[model samples]
Target: MSLVVSSINLKIYFMKTFLAITALVSFQLAAGQKTIELKDFNSLSVGSDTKITMVKSSQNKLVINSSDDDDLSIVNEGGFLKLNGGEDLEITLYYKDGLESISADADAEVWGKDEIKAKELSITASADAKIELVLNVKKLNTTISSDAMVTLTGKAENHNAVVSSDADFKGEDLLTENTNILLSSDGTAAISVKGIVDANVSNDALLKVYGNPKKVNEITSTDGHIKIVR
Candidate 1:
């Protein structure tokens, strides 16, 4: 009976020590992976010039982290999160709490080195924002109000664009079911669509469509060109 009691005590002691070490390691990891919460927000919106990347993870929280986290400001405004930063910032956005959509209205540059998976995305690129997105989403909608340069690639179900200035929009390998464009003024679009295209372009704005377009309508441009490929 004494030997049995000694064995049980030894086992309990080892279990306690193991738990202590495990807790220590967990604390260290949590400290290393410092993240800022996007609290009280269901969607993400950026109003300043910033660079953003989406991280694909199973965690359900919208958290952002950067190497230099001091100059960044993330605010929640009426159930939406807005991002603002200074200098060249590499921002990683993780949608851990079921973030559904993204909207950006600033003159920011978006690099395609990271991939974003979402249900919907809308970008209003004014003031000549150099925008590029490599995404896997259901719908992609964009509006260009200035001479912004935009590029979009990846797999999506639907794509819609509206250009109102002397901007250039390009898409490569953007396999989608439906593509729609409404261009005004000196806007130009060169895109590759896998399905159908419907465009109403006017006033020296050009539209180019490549892929099997089942239906096309009103693709007109005065002093501009409309090119289509099967």
Candidate 2:
């Protein structure tokens, strides 16, 4: 009887110890931040409900700050980085090189930390996506649709934007030599131009232009409105 009781007590103690260790490991993984090394990539595509902060860095790296690091998919495919993130996954990607293009979709929010310097940059966003970026580029191109919103600042030599499907772009702070913008389907934009503006607004869309421009050619239809102010 004494031997059997001692054996049972030992078993219980081991079980309790095992449970405690497992709980501790789970808590550590939940609370700890993970760092991942990355290769240099030119373009990035983000999907799902992830929030990312992109900033310039001396080396390429990714830091997973929230949730499990393994749950987020980060892959470099042919000089392009594709990130498929979950609703709770938050990460910061630091890159050494200038990014050429970015595509954001499906509730992803991307914020740029510092000035993005590139020869040319292209951005496309849709479906509740949001982007805030500052660029110093020769040429910039953007396409926004489906309730997405983009805010742009900094300087570009030339800019072309196509906005539709209730999207919004606030870009009055971007100093540009030339701007060509088209808006349809209740889209709206505010821009600043220094040289020339060719604007076409239709289908209840609205455009507001700022800064002193050398020339302006604007066309509006279907209750569309265009306003240019100093």
Candidate 3:
């Protein structure tokens, strides 16, 4: 019985040591992390192998330029910008009063705003890429290029949005006073709204509309299938 008790205590001690090491490593990693800030919005250029974060407080315009290589970008307007994971590069932007735009020659992803008081915003992406916008504001408008995917989520007061992709448009638990969604794809595309969706579509693309249609004021599609779910 004494031998068995000793073995159990030894195992418990080993587990505790492992947990402590893990905790220490985690704290060190977090502490070593750094934040990059872009205050002056002149002409900002980023390589296809770089990642960047930007925040704008004053009325300044920033331009993002990238090559036709693997890249990614995340932007938080007038707030702390955070970005993680990318192959070639990632760039972020924050436009206070001037125009802030992101242009990618390769596959890239961009975000409008982050965890804070929701506001009205707009986002446009280049072709042959994917873009995601998470808004906690009153309204949001988005325009996606060909061979791209645009996703919008959060609550809004009034929203007028357009999405043109060879892929699809997906939404989850989106609430808005007025919403509009438009898709133009060569393949299959769909709109899943939790609150409302009002828009139109074209091409031989497949369009699936779900969620509360009554909450969704209007929707239109051409050469595509439209489905409404309560």
Candidate with best TM-score:
2
In candidate 3 the C-alpha lDDT for residue 76 amounts to 40
lDDT of 1 at 4: 100
Query: How well does model 2 score by local distance difference test?
Result: 0.89
Instruction: Return the clash pairs for model 1, or none.
Output: 60-96, 60-97, 61-96, 61-97
Candidate 1: minimum summed lDDT over ten consecutive residues — where?
59-68
For each candidate in turn, give its C-alpha RMSD to the true structure in angstroms. 7.6, 8.0, 8.2
lDDT, residue 22, model 1 = 100
Give lDDT per model, in order: 0.71, 0.89, 0.52
Candidate 3 regions exceeding 4 Å error are 1-35, 40-105, 111-118, 187-197, 215-222
lDDT by residue for model 3 (93-158), tens: 554543333333244555555432335555554455555555465656656566656565666566
TM-score of 1: 0.70
Query: Residue-wise lDDT of candidate 2 within 1-230, one digit each (tens)?
Result: 99999999999999999999999998887677777888779998888887889879999888887545565778886788888765676688888867899988898889995999999999999998999998899999999999999998999999999999999998999899999999999999999999999999999999999988899999999999998786
- Highest lDDT among the candidates is held by which one? 2
| C-alpha RMSD between model 1 and the true structure | 7.6
Off by over 4 Å in 1: 1-34, 60-71, 97-99, 112-115
Candidate 1, residue 186: lDDT: 88
Residue 97 in candidate 2, Cα distance off native in Å: 2.1
